[model samples]
Target: MTNVLILGAHGQIARLATSQLLQETDHHLRLFLRQPERLTITDQAREEVVDGDVLDSAALTKAMAGIDVVYANLGNAKIEAQAKSVVAAMTKAGVKRLIWISTLGIYDEVPGAFGQWNHQMLDGGYLETYAAAAKVIEQSGLAYTIIRPAWLSNADTVSYELTQKGEPFKGTEVSRKSIADLVVKLINDPQQHIGESLGVNQPGTDGDKPSFY
Candidate 1:
């Protein structure tokens, strides 16, 4: 079984992916988060929770031992720093594969009025830091697939589509479950979409803003 390291395991999407992985795959998981007590272990046999910050390179490196894939669902204003730490830790630990969760508009790939709306909403700090973070991952020379998901919702559905880096981003929003589903798919076959940044959104969700907004 592959050993998977999930940074920011307390996040909503990470939690969903964790449950799905346990139910569907034989992979062993190392769930790394700052607040370990917040996460409830579903399967102790296949899951191990580590209390650590992604910014702590030593702690991150320690958690990477025997890890086959690193799925980082981390974010915040310090995202750029976190990316650098993850890259450094993974490099030191000899881990190659990474699935990075990012947000849409980091590349300004959204089109039309929606594009303007996205900029208005995210241009200040969120988009800037995330773009910088994605740059760090791309330049790190690791086999990585960066997932740039559209506006997120708590919807229970798992329907979504993808657009490549240069393509105009499609739709307005996608469910957390959909993003989780994509993460599990990549973990199952780490060879797919390596070195690519994908924009994910629900099909037919095209609009000026997310429906919830």
Candidate 2:
């Protein structure tokens, strides 16, 4: 069984991925979050919740012990700093595989009017920091697959498509469940999309903005 470290485990997508991992795979999970008490353990035998900040390199390094894969579902204005910490901790611990959850437009890959709307929505600080963070991961020399998801929804269905880094992003939005499904798929095959950045969106969701918006 592979040991997986999930940083920011309290987040919605992380929680979904955690549950799916437990139910679908026999991998052991180390759920790292600031408020550990907020997470309810579904399988104590395969899940260990750790209270620590990703920015704390020492704590991250400690949690990296025996970890085979690092799936980071973290965000915020200090994302660049967090990326640095994760890279450093993983490097020090000798772990190489990383699955990072980033957002669309990080590379301005979105096309047409939707791209402009996306910029209007996320340009200020969010996109800037996430792009910087992705840069850190790409240059870290780790076996990493960066997932840049389109606008997220709470839809229960798992329907999505992927576009490579240079390709214009497809569709308008994707469900959180879809992203979680992709994460589990990568964890099961850690080498699948190494050194590539993917843009994920729901099939037929092409529009100027998400249907919900």
Candidate 3:
């Protein structure tokens, strides 16, 4: 059975992916949540919870043990540092596959008015940090798939589109469910998108900004 380690286990996308994995597969999981008490999961079944900072190398090493794929569904400003820590731990653990969640502006891939507004809102801040982290993962020599989702929504829908790296990022929003669906797909087929950075969004949702904004 493939063992998967999910960092930032408390994140929305991570939670959704975890739920789907629990329901659809019997693979073993190691969930890393900074606040263990915040995790409401009562069933341990084939999963183990690790409570600590994602930047804690010791803790990360322990979590990565015997894991085949690493899903880093993290957010926050220190994301670059966390990515570095994960890379170091994965190297030590000799794991190859890494699916890291990033955002659209990292590559300035979002075009037109939206891109301008996104940069004005995020550029030098979140985008810079996310891009740095992506650089780390891309240079880590690991089999990695960096997933960059457009403005996220909590909509209870699964429809979405994919734009490979180099393609203009499309759409203004994507559902959290859609993101999790992609996560589940990559987990089931870890080799399907090795070395690819994908942009996911809802078809026809493109505009200057997300509807909620």
**What is candidate 3's lDDT per residue for 74-161, written digit by digit as tens?**
8788988988998999999899999999999788889999999889888767899999999999999999999999999999999999
RMSD of model 1, in Å?
Answer: 0.5
Question: What TM-score do all the candidates reach, one by one?
Answer: 0.99, 0.99, 0.97
RMSD of each candidate relative to the true structure: 0.5, 0.5, 1.0
Number of backbone collisions per candidate, in order?
A: 0, 0, 0
- Candidate 1 lDDT at 76 equals 93
Model 2 spans > 4 angstroms off: none
lDDT digits (tens) for residues 2-64 of candidate 2: 899999999999999999999888999999999898999989999999999999999999999
lDDT of 1: 0.96
- How well does candidate 2 match the true structure in TM-score terms? 0.99
Residue 7 displacement in candidate 2 (angstroms):
0.2
Question: Model 2 misses residue 118 by how many Å?
Answer: 0.3
Candidate 2 lDDT: 0.96
Candidate 2, residue 139: CA error in Å?
0.3
As a whole number from 0 to 100, the lDDT of residue 139 in candidate 2 is 100
